[model samples]
Target: MSGAAVDAASGAPRRGEPRPKAAATNQQLRQQAVDRMIEAAIALIAVKGAAGLTLVDVGRAAGYSHTLPNYYFKSKNELLRQAYGRSVGAFRRRSGAWRRQALRAPVRDDALFSTMLAYVHGGCADPAGARAVNLIAAEAVTSLPGLLPEVRLQNERMLALLQDRIEAGACGTGAAEAPASIEALLVLAALRGLVSQHLLGVPAADVDAAVRMLHGFIEGGPAGGRSAA
Candidate 1:
């Protein structure tokens, strides 16, 4: 229980100084702090929006001293970027897990639909992360080269999965030929709009219905009946 063997939950060490055997646990505690700070940022961003959230706010929310955030993260943007990465990483993990699970089930329309439904629902559940991601996406387009490679890669992976399912004819006929990249962009746009509307105090039922409609549209239903113009 040396300093190197600090407990992440309590942020306290078993002993006053480090021991060679306890180095790994100490590193684990540091990682846990970084992770906890990111999580706190997510919650605060959701409630106050990214523009309104501060390092001090994030630290307090995460049960750390006001200065602790600075020790872990150099600036607000750095913290945000890390939080954004964590959020996207979580989404990828979920999608990957769902895909792996689907491989074991009987292939059917329901399976594809269910997977897509869960994907959209997961995004909806964390509106703050969704919003932050959308913001980063918009910026990445013009910010700098390779500024958000991970985000872009995650997006591509999501689109590829949808494309594969559609091509397999599980979703329907048009899906096979539809541009997966375009479809993914459209779906992300719709999700951002829906989340934004909700954040602006739009009714929950309306937001939920809109998301469902979007899911239907993506699955080759009559959801996208309107013209882009």
Candidate 2:
């Protein structure tokens, strides 16, 4: 007790040394476990569709006992819901970045295409996103028609953003002749088609060329093709 607090066990802290903090609280630990479970769930859905995904599989994937996922979420549906929500939130954040960029830039269409390219290329670079997208599509077709209302709404907003940009860019150009919103929707449809093709094992190079072609069309028109500024 004289020099520094020393006992039969370890000694006391030294000068300028960072003190060891207390262990993580139960709430923190639980949250970490939940986060792991969610990540595992997303990864699993990406690899395999969510047809028969179970808490057991998720927990195992997360390197935890199956009971852990069960303790956090009661059912597979609940887990899927959480996973989808996370994916949507991620998409919103990415789109929002582009929206801000477009608002700040002189030409909005450029920013809008940049945004779409960001989303489209994200799927190419990140397989998990692609898998999740396919899973969502499969869910939409096989299980329910209007099952993903929130996803639909978010996508609609994205379309609106793209349309507004396209409309803005069309000023004083032949491409401006066509209705902006309609053209935006058509462009959106084209992108979706490309996504389908990519998911169906189409060559990425081909898909990328197709995207570039769409970009060309956006910049140019039926009369001629020109790279956008």
Can you write out model 1's per-residue Cα lDDT over 109-161, one digit (the tens) per residue? 35445555456555655677766666656555665334367667867766676
The lowest-lDDT stretch of 10 consecutive residues in candidate 2 is 220-229
In order, what lDDT does every prediction score?
Answer: 0.66, 0.70
| Backbone atom clashes (below 3 Å) for every candidate | 2, 0
Tens-digit lDDT track of model 2 for 91-157? 5566566556656767534655666665565555556765775586569657734446645765688
TM-score for candidate 1, please give it. Answer: 0.60
Candidate 1 positional error at 55, Å? 2.8
| Residue-level error in angstroms, candidate 1, position 84 | 0.9
Highest TM-score scorer: 2
Q: Which candidate number would show the highest lDDT if scored against the true structure?
A: 2
Model 2 TM-score relative to the real fold: 0.76
Model 2's number of clashes is 0
lDDT of model 2, residue 120: 64
Which parts of model 2 are misplaced by more than 4 Å? 6-12, 90-109, 144-147, 172-177, 199-204, 224-229
